[model samples]
Target chain A: EDQVTQSPEALRLQEGESSSLNCSYTVSGLRGLFWYRQDPGKGPEFLFTLYSAGEEKEKERLKATLTKKESFLHITAPKPEDSATYLCAVLSNQGGKLIFGQGTELSVKP
Target chain B: EAGVAQSPRYKIIEKRQSVAFWCNPISGHATLYWYQQILGQGPKLLIQFQNNGVVDDSQLPKDRFSAERLKGVDSTLKIQPAKLEDSAVYLCASSLTQGRFYNEQFFGPGTRLTVL
Candidate 1:
């Protein structure tokens, strides 16, 4: 069965801290891996899509890297604004369906 | 561009009651999706549509859940005889297209449903 797993269910860091969130997956065939940021009372906001192993994408303070079995979202010197639930999802078999991870709740305190 | 839109940001209902949620995908998007997200968990795809055609509804509880997208535009998801377990946020998302290629999904604010 295809599934996504994210570790460190919750994390707290002082502002300016850097860390990485992991998203491991078991799928029949990997089409793409996605990263999303969701704030309270809101739906997820698209962040990045990694299509292949060794692929990497970045936006401002966030960077996403993908491998055959897992993906990572690295935050650089995160601020309070960066505190949100980060979600990971995998698209398999080239279909519209997405198998999502439980997500990691991040908290950055000043 | 406007993102996906959902109606009734929140709803409270009793078990066995029926309710419906609506969604309007981004203009020109060819694919739309509805998901159920329980608190502390990621969204789970309940159904997916491509231009008014059903691409997937494997996870939807067909016995109590039904959805339709007419004219390949706005869509509606309805639940009859709701259960306590049905309490969750309903999220709608859309993408330009779906395939092996890269497609980014944009989501709406979501409708929170609370069943007592």
Candidate 2:
């Protein structure tokens, strides 16, 4: 069965603290790995998509990288505004579906 | 383009009561999805539709949960005789292609359903 597992179920980071959230997966075939940001009482917003290993994309303070067995979302000098539940999902060709990880709840303290 | 749209931001009902949630995906999106998000967990896909046809519903509780995307544009999900376990945020999302590229999925403000 395809599954996604995110590390540090919950994390607390002080302002300007840098960290990386891990999303490891086991699936038949990897189509894409997605990253999203979700605030409390709101839906998720698209963050980044990594298609293959060694591929990386950046936006402001966030960066995403992917490999055959895992993906990582790295935050550089994050602030309180970056606090939210970061979700990682794996798109599988086996069933044309996305299996999500439980997510890493990030708390950026000021 | 306008993002996905959902209605009844909040709904509270007693167990066994029937409740429905609606969704309107992007203008030209061919794929629509419904997900159930239990508190403190990731969104779990309940059903998926590709142009009004059921593509994947393996996780849907068909016995009481039903969904349809008439005309392949807008959709609705209904839970009849709801159970306490059904209390969760029902989220709607959509993407341009049914399944091919790594298109990003757009989400809407979910409907919070509370079953008493």
Candidate 3:
């Protein structure tokens, strides 16, 4: 069975604090790993896509790194605007459907 | 470019009633998807369509749930005789293609359904 799990269900950080959210996945054949940020009352916004292990991608204050069994989304000196639920999803070669994690709720207090 | 669009941002209804939600994917997108997201949980795929052809609908409860993408540009999902457990956010997403490789999916604001 393919599944995705995210740790630290909720996190609170200061305006300039840095932290990392984890996403662990188990799938038959990994095709891609994705990260998305979702704000309250809005849909999720795409962040990054890692196609293979040892791959990394970054945008502004966010960086995402991938491994064979897990992925990490690192937030550097996050601001209040960065506060949102981060979701992780994995696409398997067996199908186009995405297996998603429960997501990590982040709060960056300014 | 405009993102995926869904109508009726919120709906409240009694159990056993029927309801429907609509979605218009980004222009030129060939792949569309519908998902059910319960509060505090991840979005679960209910149905997927590739250019008006059904790609997957394994998780959809056929007894009460049905969806259609008549023209391959827009889609609608209907739930008849809704149950309490069906109260959740129905999200619509779209991708450029239904290929083996990676295809980024764009999501809509979603229709929040509350069954009383």
Give the per-residue Cα lDDT of candidate 2 at A78. Answer: 98
DockQ (Cα-based) per candidate?
Answer: 0.93, 0.82, 0.92
Error of 1 at A84 (Å): 0.4
Worst lDDT 10-window in candidate 1 chain A: A91-100
Best-first order by DockQ: 1, 3, 2
For model 2, the stretches where C-alpha displacement exceeds 4 angstroms are none
**Ordered list by TM-score, greatest first:** 3, 1, 2
lDDT of 3 by residue, A1-110 (tens): 89999988999999999999999999998999999999998888999999999999999999999999999999999999999999999998887789899999999998
The fraction of reference interface contacts (C-alpha pairs within 8 A across chains A and B) present in each candidate is 0.94, 0.72, 0.91
> Model 1: per-residue lDDT, tens digit, A1-110?
88999988999999999999999999888888899999999999999988889999999999999989999899999999999999999988745588899999999999
The TM-scores that each candidate's chain B achieves against the reference are 0.98, 0.97, 0.99
Q: Which candidate achieves the best DockQ against the true structure?
A: 1
Off by over 4 Å in 1: none
**For residue A31, what is the lDDT in candidate 3?**
90
| RMSD over all Cα atoms, model 2 | 1.0
Which residue pairs clash in candidate 1? Answer: none
Ranked by lDDT, the better of candidates 1 and 3 is 3
Q: What is the lDDT of residue A13 in candidate 1?
A: 92
